[model samples]
Target: MTHFGSNTLHVSLVALPDAVISTLAGILDVMNGAALMGLGDAKAQPPFQIDIVGERAGPLPLASGVPIEVQKSIDDIESTDIVIVPSVLLASGGWQKGRYPRLVAWLQRMHARGAMLCSACSGVFLLAETGIFDGKDATVHFGYADAFTTLYPSVTVHPERVLVISGLREELVCSGASTTWHDMVLYLTARHAGATTAQAVARMFALQWHQDGLAPYIVFEGKSDHGDGEVLSAQQWLAQHFSVAKPVEEMIKRSKLAERTFKRRFTAATGIAPLEYTQRLRIEDAKRRLERTDASIDEISWRVGYEDPAFFRRLFKRTTGMAPGAYRKRFCIPEFARS
Candidate 1:
């Protein structure tokens, strides 16, 4: 339990000249929803509010052609309850020109004054650039692990994770990718809004998968009988090429079993039928791309070998409880929004 008497949580988004504001804005929307509902606490005061800050104050464009207006500045850094930096990718590949040096200095200044700062995805670069996380446990996008490790050898990097929460003395650093941005902010939401309100927000957003206790990835531990070398080989091979166009009858022959026996054994071995397992693989594959790339729904459907966009949408919705667009929005904000 935390003391909330006269205490406020201030969220500051570290903005660059070309940063995607909506990407961060969407997260604040989720946080706002939680806060407005009495912020999950009868004793706690209403949330202080979220403000976007950078060198200047005005509208900022997203890659999606959407220009989001800003209402604050890095000068607001000193009074922030908790500051957040969105993962800002840079062309220079380091925190110099094309980066916010003044904001970097501000982070260092605020940390020294005991203010908490958090980062999302590439935003870790901003904090790392300040050298505040040296010798501390921090995380960034998995794809940038090499560059991050090489660039900041003084820090302990947590790769292979979408989110990382670091609490050190007076500072708490929370960060991850956009998908994980939901998780980090929601965790804060739960603290301010209470568990019930946080759950409500998660349900409304169709983000049950972002639950605090859930693992980022599922690990299959099939029974030994199912993993009987040959069966596992068959499963892996089937995963490699079990397309919708691939005939199940041909695969039955390949498995050396009658169709009925094949179905039963497949279910027995994997807790799902062979065809069902193929769908799982395809869905997982689709999900990964949805998280990593900025492809349109129709394009993603084709890439995953689905011929009908409508059917693809249905399957994706059935599995994820959200549409492809929302899924992508949850991970990487689209290019048009980056404008």
Candidate 2:
């Protein structure tokens, strides 16, 4: 392990051709800002020394077609305190396995040397390629959850978390979604520097940390690619009629499968039982109504198929971790009634 001087820490931002340019630049800017803030203090020098390192030194074009000048190549760096892999624009065929063997090998070496690895969004794909995240929990962009799970089945994917720290030593840090670079940088700043410095940087950037998990923004679209014809038809029917009370019997009859068979197949395909699926669908609709309409919680709950207002409130809180009124208050349009 490379021992860092008491006053300074080295950081490497891995520059990839397919990386999102804004994320890379934004991380660098925030780190520099933190460093500057620390430097202003008489007793403390800046803790971070950041470098933009690429697979090969020189200019590397981002997915946006903008070229970022890299200060050093990965081969030139023998050791660093931290390594940050920025998100990449997924290609048409998806993240190609073994596409950057050299970079993967370098990352492996760095981790083996005890440097912490942090990834943002799809950058988790690269870290997964190193097998470092295998058997560990990690998060990535919600859009890529299915693909990431399909690719790395061993790693537990938390699609709803904005950030996750895994590994026995907690050396692997991951941030979900593309814009979560703000959250990741702030977290790193707080971990390495201090809360005061992190808060100052947050104030400077006007960046608010999203403490709520990503669940509120996620729409529970039923997965239908399970290749079960009867299940697919039932799913389609349920999607159209989730607001209907007592959908299980109707779904089973429409599927033409016996009750046991229908329930089993639906659970296997969707990872949730039929009634639970309907509840999720109804709650999803209720969330939409809460956000876009001035409707009261009881009215919205009944409209979404709940007959018991108290039951609906509990279910809403259980599913979303917030009361129905709180959800509306946070998400409802300002022009709509604020009740």
Candidate 3:
């Protein structure tokens, strides 16, 4: 395991210089806090180092009427393990040529040398502007997806998911909205700091340990302003436990409905059977584990509670139109190799 100082995953924040938004800074605050807490709790320093770097080393204004001084410049970003570009105003208008001149040059220098490029929220817009996210699997905040899609049609944008870590191409990742940033930091922490260290950090902050590939949006905990009591209860349970579907018998017990009546009621309530609903939940869970964990097909099958890998394979392949292995190749953000 590495400490923050030891791992030091330098993050370069590309501020739009007068972009008037501190979204990036805010994200940095949270990430740095998480890192410090994550690493400090493990009784170790995280192997990661985060730097809010940009075109220059100076004060940058935010939409909140505040300015944060930039401590690192483009030249200072050399050989960084991770370069993050936060959301800034497009008015800078430097990335139109996929070459914001200085930004482009910096990105080229680091990218060519195999550094990871990370984009947060609207920051993804700037990354796309660099032509680096092109043909890559990425994501933007839900609000900005439409504009991003309209602007960069060549890049494959995943709308349903909150964050995307592209197929193991030199550590490129694009994520925005929901708790995606939290997941990203945890991932980086685990990678640099190790799972044991990461767990220690999580325990320190009382943060729940997360499995990569589960989108933050799927955990909508607060009650919606609409829906009946039974509906809301079911929906809440579904949201919380969709990854590990409750047994139908358990659900029936909880609902206190007879089998025949429960079937009719559940179907009428959500237009889906209890069993079917649970199946969908398991499928989604299996799909997530498939994409994130380095575990083999059998390992993943078991992780999702499938006793028979063959049946899991059939169900997965049938639903996704590709074998589990092939699906991993097709949809996995960080493509695996036999190291």
Best prediction by lDDT: 2
Measured by TM-score, how close is model 1 to the native structure? Answer: 0.57
- Judged by whole-model lDDT over C-alpha atoms, candidate 2 comes out at 0.87
In the range 1-339, model 1's lDDT, one tens digit per residue, is: 322335556777666655556557766777676455443466766555788777778877754556767787777556666778776655554544325678878887877777777877667776888877877888776666557888889988765454566656636565554567777776776665567666777877776534322122332233345565545766767666755466356567777877788777777877776666666667677877887776777887887768899998988776655677766666665677765
- Which of 2 and 3 is ahead in TM-score? 2
Taking all chains together, each candidate's TM-score versus the true structure is: 0.57, 0.92, 0.54
Candidate 2 residues 1-339, lDDT tens each?
Answer: 112125777899999988999999999998888655443464555758899998898998899999999999999999988999999999878888888898899999999998999999999999999999999999999999999999999999998899999887788999998788789998988888777778888988899887777777778888888998888898888888988868899998887888999899889988999998899999999999998888888899889888899999999888887788988888876864556
What shift in Å separates residue 248 of candidate 1 from its native position after superposition? 33
Candidate 1 stretches greater than 4 Å from native: 1-6, 35-44, 62-65, 92-98, 209-339
The order of the candidates by lDDT, greatest first, is: 2, 1, 3
Quality of model 1 by C-alpha lDDT: 0.67
Give candidate 1's root-mean-square deviation (CA, Å).
Answer: 12.0
List per-prediction Cα lDDT, in the order shown: 0.67, 0.87, 0.64
1 or 3: which has the higher TM-score? 1
Clashing pairs in 2: none
Candidate 2 all-Cα RMSD: 3.6
What tens-digit string does per-residue lDDT give for candidate 3 at 1-339?
Answer: 334444456666667653435456555664566455544546654465677777778886654557877788888655877877765554433224343578877787888887888876667766676677777888766655556788889888874455678745647776666446555656666766566655665565455533333332332123344454665576667655644544666666667768788677667776667666665567677667767777898887776667789998988765545578876765677534525
